[model samples]
Target: MILKLISRSKQLVPHSPVRILSLYAVLALLLFSAVLLVGLMPADAHAARILEPKQISGAFPTLAASFNPHEQVGHDQMENMDHGHDSGLSVSTALFYTARIVYYTALLMAAGMMLWFSGIRSGSDEQRKRMQQWSLPMMRALLLASLLYVFANARSLMEGYGGGGPEWLRLFTETNTGQAWLALLILSLLGFAVIKASDTFKLIWALLLLAIESWSGHVAALQSNMNLGIVLDFIHLACAAVWSGGLMILLGLWFVDRKEAGRFAERFTTAAWISMALLIITGAAITLLLLPSLSYLFYTSWGIWLIVKIALVALVIVTGALLRARVRRGELPDGLMLKVDAGLMLVITLIVGVFTYMSPLPDNTPVRFHKMGETRHFTVNITPNEPGTNQFEVKIWLPEQLGEPSEVKLVLHSRDRQQLAPLEVPLAIFEDKSYESFPGFVRTSYHAEQMDIPFPGKWTAELQVVDKSGEKVEESIDFENY
Candidate 1:
């Protein structure tokens, strides 16, 4: 069976160097595809314990500073509780990295395909023969390297999926490994030999690694349906590789084959336009799905970075158009045109790099509460329901005369509020009133001026409340102390 396959491969139609170049072209595409797959499949879980309170607050100080407009001050301060925005930000960041790889890889691959097809269509038989001769070795080397790179990165890709490990490590350890390094080395050497020998069958064999690596990411059964994300990620990645790989080829041809520059540029222009359209359409779709809310887009650092990246993309498009027009008018020399195009390509690469760290917006909006105002007093009324577990009734009395409490919290005493800890109070809320359970103590939910204090020693409770300005306010219990 293998012998038959080898015979068939060697007999591929037109058996020219152009056909052989397809092998390298495909390999380049697969490499970027793998990158996209790894990148878009969701980043490995990194949310372990947040750093110190200061660090948590500092990581996004800009967003933090703007919290007043978007959040409740004094209540639900940024110092506590992991915000859902973090998750959204993470999603966006991961996709940004993936998108970057996709864009560049797609550009290179698309350029290559464009140049190859165009050259073949217009060049003479001798020119075609020269291309074939040169392409054989070059394609072989690229194919070999691509195979190794893919396999080498496989383990890191697999690690993204939950595997057996220490509980903490499972959530935080990010692996960038591919597969067994030694195995990759051996395969790379062997593939190199096969390509050098023009063993066409081995090319297909090399492609198998890419297929396997991509498939491994789709084996999940969780609420996130990570499997679906993995699949979409792969599709997105494959498209990117084709686009980038082709671009690389086109660029190389435009520079090296100056005599045939016109044909090469024309071919690349068409491919670039098509690739750009696909890039914009797919990117928009992904953005819409990932960034559902405009608020998330504006309130997070990820959103801001994304805006920056999109602006760069706009510049790239404009520059690309200018270069194409110059080439058509024959106003600019091939050398200068190539340099300008290359510069534009670099700008595109830079945009992708910036995208690597931003996060995506969330699909749903989280519930938010208002902060206590000057008229309001931070209050917590706990009523005993059982011997051990108490129904916790927590509320910030909005002074009917003034407005709302200065702050609201859940704690034994107001003094305990600054302790920056969650109060393990058995608590429940009933409408406007709160209920709590205290051992050997009892109290009603609504008692004239907030009843339901059992234990002495100035017990306090801490609660997060938002101010009118939407800034989080950290109000504590005053109790016997301040």
Candidate 2:
């Protein structure tokens, strides 16, 4: 019905200059609106709450007290010790993920045009003109998407780093993500400059742009085999772009002229098979590198999201198979089925964006242990025993006093086999003595003041309890960081 309308409209106004100009103006206005929407989006909620040096120093009293009389650990050190323990699904995170989805979809559309235009021989003059007309709007959308993508990256950085001043500039100049964004911007410009050159050149440029995506993802920092992982990531992204993007272009063709698109559908089907195979291989390689065990698939949020993506991909495959069967039987593929497949692919792409910010497995698990000493029994509980900042708590039970001890102190030693100064955390006695501190009305025990673990790796926690006689009893326990 839409194609019939298009045909009728073209016949009615075949050479109406006013109508063509008005259509182009409307498209330009829409593109401008999209750019404005991204630019005017609100900043993240937490961006305003970034603590200054004084604020950080005041937050952790124990850490500030440890400063030497002549020298103090500066703001940088304190800031490093502070971790963003807030939930991952923030408004800013959601916006960035949405931006990513938009960017990837635009990329596929642009690249898919190249793939489609390159695979088939030139059709009649009318078909060629139609393809060119479609390409112009697609290219414009791609450029707009690239701009939005860069804006999203910058916005995320600004929110994460607190302000859009020197800190944000430093990140842009120093980080891999910044470098990749810069590279993408350059590529986008290059693509625009040579868009009217040749189909081969456009195809090469699109693939290169897609490959650059690897640099900004987890593949760039893979610990086991960084180089191979990045290469595989590039392959995965390229194949995905071709498969998803190609389908989008084919759908556009179906809308424009179903018969012409069907002529090349068989060839695209063959390429799609190869693309799917490569996607599975490369995606599996990257997934194995990330997930420690199969248990994570059901246990971790990242793993569950990954499973959803896998199921969506499977659905796409099934839909593609059904479409191929229809095509083979000389029947036009159902547009609704194709739409469902495209929608699934879109969701899968968005999930990939979300995965970029989420961890593949759980990182924080509290460590608990008990130690029997000569004069004191210590029950230690370390909350969120992760590699970053952590809270350390100890409850000392004095068998003789039948009341709270006068003093409690904690010293941390890095068990890295290198000689280092001990980090002392003075524990203040909780005056309120809540039920958690004295669960049984036996006032012999009091909760020690909590302290933060500023760093990770193997560490030993030495607890010292001073009795009324000024005698100190010490107990040490060793543990590894997450």
Alpha carbon lDDT of each predicted model: 0.41, 0.62
Tens-place lDDT per residue, model 1, 314-403, is 765776687678767864335654565556555555555444323452222211233345444444533332111233444455424333
How much is the lDDT of residue 410 in candidate 2?
A: 75
Predicted candidate 2 versus true structure: per-residue lDDT over 13-55, tens digit per residue: 1324465446545644643453344234332111111123344
**Cα distance off (Å), candidate 1, residue 439:** 23
Worst 10 residues of 1 by lDDT: 43-52
